[model samples]
Target chain A: MNRVNIVGIIVLIAIAIASPIIAGSFFAPPPAFIGPEFLVQIVAWGLIIGCIYVLLASGLNLIFGVMKVVNFSHGEFMILGGYVSYWVSILVGLDPYLSIFVSMVVIGLVGVLTERVCFRRVLGTSKLNEIILSLGLIYVLQNAMAISWTDKPIQIRSPFEFVTVSFGVVRMGLDWLIVIGVTVLIMAGFYILIKRTEVGRAMRATSQNRSAAMLMGINVERMDMFSFGLGTALAATAGTLLAILAPITPQAGAIPALKAFTIIVLGGLGSTIGAVVGGLVYGLVENSTIVLLGATWKDAIAFAILILVLIIRPTGLFGEKEA
Target chain B: MNILSDLRKGLKTPKIYLPILLLLVCLLIPLFGISPYFIHVLAVTFFYISYSSSWNLLAYSGQASFGHAAFLGIGGYVTTIFTIQTSIPWLGLLLGALVSAFAGILVGLTCVRLREWFLALVTLGFSIIMVALTIELHWLTGGVYGLAVPSLLPSVNHYYYGMLALTVFLVFIIYLITKSKIGLAFVAIRENESEAKATGIDVTKYKLLAFTMSAFFAGLIGAFYAHFISYINYQIFHLDYSFWPIIISVIGGIATIEGPIIGSSLMFCIIEFLRVIRPLVETIDPVIKLNYPKIQVLLMGIILVVVVIKMPKGISPWLRKYLISISK
Candidate 1:
């Protein structure tokens, strides 16, 4: 791990430890567990949620990094993913984990189609035009879902049987472990793909300069579609996993999308590692605050931190200035 | 021969004659046996005209503010809180305007330093923050349930007249601003910011001035809106409401004095008419439960896409060109 990662991990661990002590002092609590067990649960939730955010932000970062286009509909794509899982589960009576492959494929095609039909035409336009277009698209997709599925929140019941693993003092749901495990698996796979694959090299080249990549025989249009599709598919997958953790609604994607935007900005846009680190930081800040200071201030924390980041370091922690 | 000459000269100044004629027609609508509900819609359309016109003032200077809804919220919330929470209505309006203007100045200072895109992002951030605060600070804002407000006018006609007068006042204000050297300053900033600054234009002051002025009227109208609606909620000041004015200005043709007026009229008509189709369809054909909300959003998206693709200069520019060509 790099120095930043090391520093981030240490700070996160410190926050995890200090949070419960702070919470216990603040409010009357049922003594669920003592020192180590509480600490482990907090860390586990923090890591799992943080990694989910990173998953969301990484896709967003890639889209922004390469195309310099902010997809306002990113959250909706995730919601769409959740809805997909919801339906697939109902139709096949299959496990959500087993359906992930099918969900990704459908959303991947959606990403490609969205890029080709809408975003491709608007490429190279002024940022203002692109922003408005994406926003309009968001309205369209959000309302479409609302119409198709009555705008009510639906719980996608996890197939995981209630199993808790106790590591000395720490004990929690088996589902939580799956979340962390999946996050790690996805992160590792993404890292290898970007670092080791030819497509990843082409993406890097295009992100550096589109015209330059075209001159180097890289198909710029195809690359753009691929990047957008990859980003969008990842967004859907994140949504699907998040559905396992919580309930799903047509409008569920909006808040998560905002959080993802914050993470990407905080980590520095388009930096893959930065997105993951930022996501973890965000998760800790959000979940820890909820644990310690009641659930009322959760959304506020996300935006407040984002504004602070923007004001302090507009370039973000690992951000390169975009053209 | 004298009458013909007079008519010809009058026709030459379409701007002056056209608005006066439209105003006369709007004033006569209540006399035509139209329902009060339709009148309310017209009042809202007028209100949006003022709101979107002020928005165009900022857009003219090339600043797209997402926090515009915050100013509107501030105006509405401040006025309502004072009216309901305390024994004041007029004082609330003034104070709300001041507070909203001050908030605009603060947001402007932070955002005006950035590029247009960053400015939009920051404003969008502020809008979201404002919405969140409205929900979180339920004690003050009444949360998602909304706050009941006292009316500035005693009746719907009173509200209608108030909105009408305000709309006309705002249109004249915007026209005067754009007609002057400041209008040229706005156009300068829009076309090329660096060049405008180098040419001795105080770009920063011009931008800040535009933003503050835009907020001033936006806040003013929002304050009046709270009194007119007699209720204020998070929904009224949500980001969705915030977006309409921007889209209006864009669809109407950004920066033109009459653009927002036309844009607001068109949007209101579209929304109102499209809504009518739902009930009509349900009555005439019972088999289909027409989803109005879905259709409305879908239509708006399609309109936005089609407008950007076909009429990038917006409708007003084209209308003006066509009119001029026909006259020639």
Candidate 2:
């Protein structure tokens, strides 16, 4: 939108492209160029990880856009979804994949309840109140899950465990394929829901202008609940995917939640497309940083990018509203 | 001349002496020969009062930082590292605060232009980055095992007295700041940044000043905490450290001098009370015992929700209202 922003974006793109090459040349293996395979592996892993982030960040962006509330506890909902799927899979002896839908539905209902009980009262109040309230919810949800399930990290056993598919030089697990496919399908369905359905129109209308939407006779309250629930359901789906991909713990949501926050901020606060792009960039940056600077720098690099983006463009890449 | 007049006016208010009286009572607690454990809790409570007060200072300026533990951890680690390398405890403490102030300025530079949720997220990011760095640079920080720092002074009674003195000094300074023109700028910025800017207040400068001062005090408390606990670790940057001050500030009163002091004391007592009752609760119902942590968290959550919904002004202001009504 402005000269400074365009220049900043170009500079960042140049750095992102050049860093690996520079690092690879200096820190490459003795054979040299073998590092390319490692780079490929990192990229593949980054894409899979980014897919989960897309879901998580999109949900957060959706809620913020529609309700104008930042749900700091969204990660807890994701973890809750993971736990639900885990329990359902274990008790009902269903596949983890199938249990994802069940977890999404359950968590969606929980989100609706959360909206009505915790957030609804503070809907149009001070931003600080919403933050504090979400924090309180974080404590309640994380501790409650910890109490019921214990704090030990547990992995949901997928039916496709031990199955890996290799495409040329790239190898990935079958579960990852399904996870990516499902994420895309869910995102596509969400896009359709927002673009085609009457409820979707209401949500977009409210997000654009709440007062105008209300004047148009839209049931803004119901739309608020619906959008919150839908956003949470998306987070739940990401959680289920995470449960299958990695170990799930009550505290597992904290870091990813923070990462999702960074993604939304980087992608622009209330943009779905920005969330997707930001999530992918975050994933790539995180994984590549690991390759360049070791595993310890993975989390730090994501935040570093976030800070850089904020400094250059305070409203974020796609953010239209000024803070 | 203005300072003397302000002091005189402050002294004219009878209510102003309440905290002084309370501080005297706290100082006199060890004279009764209290248990070492009680003294430890009291000292930690005082430390939290200082810490929460520092947090309130920034919030008073209309900036709510969620990553305050970054300064706390920085203070702890910097002091511990300095003392470990040089073996000069006093210099280490001062250096720790200075280093934390420096870090705060860096963070504030990135955050001064942001507002509300964006600011909160950036601070949170910095805290997380600090923790990651602490762990990554394990050779210096001793990694997850943590490092032990020398005690600030011998005995729990000494810690109690030291913390009490520190709390009093810092709260007084904060009170002075809040009453000054700088404090007016902070309030103006928080109330309405655009209007404050329109009035030529240089909102960024005051906000950054609030950030620096708050971090300096938070670091001081953290340095004291490290010595008091005799252990410093990356875990100091955990969400618990950040949340404790917020919960206390909300419970006591936000943006008030006495709020953090009251909130810290009450919350510490509640936590200690729960700990003391754990065995009794276990004997009565073993199932509940297993869920004790969850129950405590649930209660805190419920309290936060209820407070935000019902008494958003918090306990201190609420108490003042009741007192005024009863007097009438």
For candidate 1 chain A, the 10 contiguous residues with the lowest summed lDDT are: A314-323
TM-score of chain A of 1: 0.88
Cα error, residue B207 of model 1, in Å, equals 2.2
TM-scores, each model vs. reference: 0.90, 0.95
**What residue runs in model 1 are displaced by over 4 Å at the alpha carbon?**
A1-40, A320-323, B1-11, B135-139, B143-145, B283-290, B325-328
> Candidate 1: lDDT of B76?
90
lDDT of 2 at A93: 99
lDDT of 1 at A216: 99
lDDT of 1: 0.78
Per-candidate DockQ versus the true complex? 0.43, 0.64
Query: TM-scores for chain A, candidates in order?
Result: 0.88, 0.91
Candidate 2 chain A weakest ten by summed lDDT: A24-33
The best candidate by DockQ is 2
Write the residue-wise lDDT of candidate 1 on B14-38 in tens digits: 6558777899998888888888998
Off by over 4 Å in 2: A1-36, B6-13
Docking tier of model 2: it is medium
